[model samples]
Target chain A: MASTIAEKIFASHLRDTPTPGDAVLDIDVVMCHEITTPIAITDLMEKGMDRVFDPDKIKAVIDHVTPSKDSKTATQAKILRDWARRHNIKDFFDVGNNGVCHALFPEKGFIRPGYTVIMGDSHTCTHGAFGAFAAGIGTTDLEVGILKGVCAFKEPVTMRVDITGTLPVGVYAKDVILHIIKKITVNGATNKVMEFAGPIVDRMSMESRMTLCNMAIEAGGTCGICMPDRTTAEYLWPFIDDKYESVDDAVKDFKQWHSDPDAHYDSTITIDVSDLVPQATFGFKPDEVKDITDIEGENVDQIYIGSCTNGRIEDLRAAAKVLKGRKISRNVRGILSPATPSIFNQALEEGIIKIFMDAGFCVTNPTCGACLGMSTGVLAEGEVCASTTNRNFNGRMGKGGMVHLMSPLSAAAASIAGHITDPRKYLQ
Target chain B: MKQFGGPAIFLDRNDINTDEIIPAKYLTENSKTALKPFILEDLHLEGFDPQSDELKNAGVIVTRANFGCGSSREHAVWVFEVNDINVVIAESFARIFRQNMFNCGMLAVELPKEDIDIILSMGNVDIDIDVTNGVITAKGAGEKTFNFTLNDFARELIQAGGWLAYADKKY
Candidate 1:
């Protein structure tokens, strides 16, 4: 019988029923924030379910309102901390040691390719960057995972997004994703697993790959994944046990991208970066976008180049290099947050941190930070922000604050201009 | 189940996401009953309110197109059920919300998109869905026929009022 890369990995972990994708496969990793855990634990207790299926498989992080601003959100954070201990949940990544759950979990090795992971955030597809099948769920679903150690999911139609050829000199992975969203529009992937394959994808770094999969859900997909390869194993080797080897074996064994040749998809979208340049989202919706050079006089009040979308060390460096010899405009508050502690350390070693701080930008510790309205660097009411995070909903970052999503390069340029400006105009 | 008036106050539309049905914050309740106040809250906080004159007179709703489009919050259905809205009429529904509503006794009524607009535009006008003839009769709106089709299980569940009631009788 033939199986997709995700099905093969899920089949390996099934101990009881091996009925393909319909069966509830065992979960290798689980994550819950403070907000959801309080209720999930309550449900498990009412059902007389004692002891989590495996506390070690879960990570409870205080990301939603980290650095809890006032006494109210702080009170909620404390409840999360107490519940973490009561449930004996392990991997409770704390303040200063954590960023967004999506970015930090994979960086720390809880996720490996060819594995099935379930978390409480829809963007859990972020784990797919490592070649794993991860999706988000609700509180009740998390409760089921905590007790049964499995999640019920159907096999999604496989979509092979073949992106080959070279990207223009100034373009980065962010531009590639924005280009895909534009062609497909929103709700394009309804219920499918998008496997990004091709020469360009293989050459992209793990951090860049994560950024792509992270936005897959915006198109209404179940999840998005890439095939595990040599780079996949290298990234996992440090934090995971050496005994748990060959992380990419299943993906490579099956040649991950082969789609049954006859396998059909409900939809398809191709992106050719031959003439692409730095891009940004112009309006409230992600698909409402523009090339950096297209718009004039769009004022930017804040510039943030961080979050699960573009919060890697490379993303920081790309922006920091632009901010090197200059300062952030007086009225603008430029935020440079690395996605993980390890990435933060790497930036420090590479002098990226010095460049960012010397530019008069505020260097925040790792966190999702206002990316999903979780509150780390929220703009005041009516403030206009040019950010590298996903989503710019009406009140996503505070009441009435206008959000403009952009690539890291564009955000840095906007920081220098104190308004939404193009990077090509500022670059050497 | 949040209120006695609705097995579910049906709405029209398919692909109704959790984001459109309810704002994201209410999904974490340990008790599913807490979700009763948020249905259709996304369209207008007032429309889903029990006190809203437009909705108070009608006990159920049905819609066309993607009924609930974003987020998988079960609260979306709960809010509708709480507002006394019962029997969702739509051509299709989001996969997650449909499954959740079925588990809670919210009958998901499937029909074509054109039929749904007839029912919605004629608000407060109750229609008798002739399942056999695949027709809906909207009072003065003159034979605003519809095609009400349902899987055997969903049909049985709605007939029984909800899952708990269905299970109580069948199991």
Candidate 2:
């Protein structure tokens, strides 16, 4: 039978022919962060296991709540550092050198086409942009992956999301994804793999594609994947090892990674982005989205443009384009955090940091800061923030905080307006 | 993983995410005791607190669709386990949250929407679950039995006291 990309990846890893919902022992990479790794390492130690199955396959990063917000977090980081050193883990990225785990891992060539990656962070699905099968697992499962080098997975049904039209000038991948999440409720794609296809996906940059896949969990999807194409090969070429002579060779090697023409999907949904407007979440859930123009003016106290979802260099450039000559409203405290150190350095070289600073934005080091309400730029009670992050759950930024999820352009526009506004108005 | 009975507390809300179950603020602590008082504290349900006398005494929780959505934090399930919540019945659950529950040997039963509504209407009812038969019996007003679904692997994991114990035996 013809198989979807997800099925193909699963079957390649399995010894037997794969079927939907079949448990398979396939995991290429296991990753965790400061928040979740301490528990998994402690569990491993308690089990009398002194070393991980393979230290090379394990990736540990200190991204979330990094720089030690409190004594508890500091101790947790210490535990992880001690465990990584003891295990001789080669891929450990400490607090200062670390970015968001999801973004940094892919840039370091840890994720590749047709590989099955598992991480303790839900945004591990972000790696699926490179045509890999990546899903979030709990700390216990992470421990299992570390010990056994393989974790069990119940195959997920595939949902084909075909975007048929070109995105408008001001609209972004964030808008397209938020629009889809609104059409499909929070639980609409529960336990399914979302396979993105059609023209819009083909034209999207790697960073934008990552932005789309990063929030697949928001709609309850196990993973979100796109076919490996020239763009994917080109984006990974620089970071990839010396094995591949050229980008064309890498693309040629993964030629079979695409879904079969006759592949059977459980369901198919078509979305046209031609007339789609820039979107922003009006409520707590990411699905509660509205067209930027439809939302009335609501004062915002903060504006954040960074996360695994929208902290890439492209996102920084988009926000910087809007804030170049203008200052953010005095009532609003704006923040810009790049997704990785490389992206941060690129932004600094491109003078995006200077533009943000000129616009009165507080530029912070790369972290999952303020996105999970863990540390840095937390909101006070009843305060409102326009963020480029994926989730807008209640108090996601801080206690009693109201979050409006939007594209970086929209976030920058809101920062200048002190209220939700259309980015197209500020775009050159 | 056999027969078990407990008082059921109704959380009449949908999409009860992990952040609300145990907010990110409390995730720094690794101890169950440190996370106990804050169970469902951030949920901010009208007139409901997981630590209240009414909830503290209850062992089963019934909720609406997509319970335990958002974030892969298993601390959400750990918080419930520490609070003595043995089972969670919902119309539906986020995939990661359900797996997290099973990994910890806690029961997360999925009932039909109508059955969940019926259970929620009955205040402070005792629920008897038969894991082998996948049935939930509510002892209130009149005896009502509802059929639920549990995959075979999950049932085995629960019987063996979660993934760690199951792994111990299998590996």
Candidate 3:
């Protein structure tokens, strides 16, 4: 049978021919963050194994509760730092040095095409934008990877999602994904790998592709991956090591990282986004997304424009375009957090930060921040927010606080209007 | 590990995500004890406090589809373990949540929808798990037997007291 991208990647790491079942595969990279790493370390220590299998393959970052919100979290970060240093792990990124693990992993070039990556983070699938097969594992499974350098998996069936037609003006990649999730339902793709393809995907920027792959878990998918193309290669060129003769050479090297033309898939879903509108979630689940026009005048007390989902420079630029020269509603509080320090620096250089600051927005440091309800900008009881973060499960932002997920454009527009409003007018 | 029986608590809702199982606020604290009070606290199930005696005493939890759907936090599973919830029989489970259960040496069985409904109807009845035979038996009025599925790999991991113990023995 022709191999899907996931099958091709998994088979490359094993000596035996790949079958559609459980098998232990070697991992190219193992990533973890503050929230999950300490637990894995504790498990390793409890097992009386003090050393990691390979420090080189492990990437640890303090992102979730960075700057140490409280004494408890500070102690947890201390334990991770101590453990990484004791093991001489070279890829450890301390607070302020690293942003979110998912964004930083790609920004630092730790993820490459056709690699099998595992992390103790559900959004680990975000790395799949580079044409890699990545998925999240629990802390104990991460402990197993740390000790054995390999993790077991029950081969997931592939669900081919093909997007056609150019996205309409004012609609972003976030809308496309939210639309797909709404169609697929929250549990539609459970235990499956979603292989995104077609004309629209072929034309999407790297950041947009990352946005799509990042939320695959929201629909209960194990992972979502796109085959690497020239666009992917171009986005990765700058991050490639100096060993490559040129960007063209780097692209040439990634030629082997794609699914076969005849790759087999369990199911196929096709969506045309030519008439797509900006989408926003009206309820707790991402699948509750509706077109921006359908949700006009829904009031909100806050608006957030960042997270691993929509915190890229492109997302910032989109929100900046909407917020430029416009004052936000006095009744609303707005925050714009970049996904990584690199993106934050780029935004500053481009004056995106100036636009946000002049618009009465609180431009915070890059961290999971308010997305996980951990630190700064957490929602208060009875408050409603229009946000660009991925999950909107009840109390995701804070106790009794509600969130409506949307694209950065829509979120910024909502901040201006103090309600969930369409961004098309602002875009025009 | 063969036959074990305990009182079962039925949660009829579907898509009971990890956020509902254990919210992100409680995730900052690593202690299993600190997590007990918050287990299923977000569910707002009428007359059921996660800390109340009624829920604290139940050893098995029966629920509908997609139990533990969001976030890869093992704390969702840890909350159950700390609260003495040894087994969770759901119609389906999110992949990561299911694996976390096995990693903690807790049993997460996927039963047919009809069987889950039958199990729920037998409220407060003792449900016995037969790991070796892959059977679930309810010891109450109209005692019923239902078959469940467990791969050998997961069973072995549970037998060895979770992934940590299994890894120690392997590596």
Candidate 4:
């Protein structure tokens, strides 16, 4: 049968031969972070199911509200700390060693092609950039996954989104994804896998692909996937080096997870990015996107450039390129997080942190805090922000505060302009 | 089956996300019940007051499409469950929120747009849901009955008092 990559992965994980409807498939990785994992940890402990399927396959981090924002958050982290210690989970990452779980786990080569991963956090779909069937699940599913190493899902259906055409200068992967979400509306891909393909996806760096897939949930997609290829093999090569002779050999083996040319899709759509420009959101929803020109010059009180969505090295480089030898507008409070300690150290070593600090931006340790308004860089009432994070839901940054979602480059440019500004101007 | 229905709180907008449903600020709370008073506290829907008697007294929520759209936190569902809002009938729900509802032994009823329109037209009517029969009845003024669909797995979850119990029995 001609199967899409998502279907192939799902079928491969099932204990029995694939069935037509709801199938229980084994979970390869159960990623957890402090805020949500503690709830599951509490529940599992209460129910006498305080056991992990495999400690080696479990990865935990304390990225959200790190350094113990409050007593509650501190306790949450401590619970995860004790639980990981009790289980002898070697991959557990606490504050200083932690980054955002989505960015940190993949950086550690914890995810691979054809794996089925679940995490209580929604952005867990970020790992699907590696050609895995990764979905953000709820607490109950998280508990079941931790205990039994399996999860239930309906038979797979896919929507093939072929993003073709040349990406314009200053229009990065964040813009491309924002464009796609605006075209498809939020919930356009509900209950289905979003298969991102075409030349554009093929050319994207693995970081760019992760940025693209990270917001799959914003579009109500169960998972967003790119077929594993040379880029994927190269990104994972350091960890899988002994298993494969070379990157080419690893790429050849990954071909088993690719979709057949004739695979069935519930729907097919194509997005041409040739004329695309830098995009930013206008309202509470992720789909409320507008071209930068349409909303430029709206004064922004804050500018934040980080999150699992666009907080990697590439994102920092893009933002730094615009911020070099420039100062942020006096009215704007700029904040930058590098996603992980490794990315943080790399940014410092590359002088990116110096560029940001000199540009009057506050560089914080890697944490998912400010992105969700849990800590650091939270907005006051009636404030407006230009952010690189995913959701811009009303009060997402803070109650009565407005957030305009944009790319890292655009966010950095907005910090200079003190409002929403086009990043292409800086590039030129 | 755990049957439930109540006076419906009409949040007439779309894309009611988890953040608005429970807010990220309260995510650190120790227990789900601590989330009760804060349900829909951050949602800025027209004519919807989170603290109003209409909201506090609501047993069901009839909202527009793509409800519970952001953040996979089950706290959104827990907030509703803690508030005794056992049912949310909408045009559609974000995938994870729907599953989370069933995992909590709650009902997230997705009706067709036309059916939703009919229900909304009934004004502030109370509702009664029959889980086994999959029927929703509007009580008082615009008295009407509508059939909704719940997939087999979701029904089983609700029947088994959520995923944990189901796992205990099967796994």
Cα lDDT tens digits for candidate 1, A1-428? 66666666656766433243344567888787755555667655665664577878878787766677666556657766776787788688778776777788877778876677886566787788877888876555676666667765655666668787888776888888877776665466656777787778888888889988988766666778887777776777676545554656543643553344544555555666778877777755566668877765588777787888889877887887678899889988888778778888999999889988988878888877767555567777679888888766555555557788778888888888888776876667
**Model 3 root mean square deviation, Cα atoms:** 1.8
For candidate 4, lDDT tens digit of each residue in A266-347? 9999999999999999998999999999987998999998999999999999999999999999999999999999999999
Interface RMSD, prediction 3 = 2.4
Task: Please give, for residues A1-428, the per-residue lDDT of candidate 2 as tens digits.
Answer: 88899988988877322234646465788887989878888877877865687888889988988788889999999998998899899899997789988888988988899998998888888999999999998887887788877666777589999998878888999999999999998898889999999999998898999999998899999999999988998888877648788888888887787899999998999999999999999988888889989995877999999999999999999999899999999888999989889999999999999999999998898999899898878999999999999889987888899999999999999999989998898876
Q: In model 2, which runs have C-alpha deviations exceeding 4 angstroms?
A: A15-20, B1-3
Tens-place lDDT digits, model 3, residues A1-428: 67888888877875322233766778889997889888778767875877788999999999988789898899889989999999989999997788988888888888889988999889998998999989999988898888878777777589999999888888888999999999999899899999999998988898999999999999999898998878877777777757578777777777676777887889999999998988988887789888889879998999998899999999999999999999999989989888899999999999999999999999888899899898878999999989898988988899788899888998999999888888889877
| DockQ of the candidate models in sequence | 0.21, 0.60, 0.64, 0.69
Per-residue error (Å), model 2, residue A210: 0.3
Superposition TM-score, candidate 4 onto the true structure: 0.98
For model 2, the DockQ equals 0.60
Pairs of residues clashing in candidate 4? none
Report the C-alpha displacement of residue B167, candidate 2, in angstroms.
2.8
RMSD of 2: 1.7
Which CAPRI level is candidate 1? Answer: incorrect
- The model with the greatest lDDT is 4
Best by DockQ: 4
Q: RMSD of each candidate?
A: 4.7, 1.7, 1.8, 1.3
* TM-score of chain A, predicted model 1, versus the true chain A, to 2 decimals: 0.91
Model 3 residue B36 lDDT?
Answer: 82
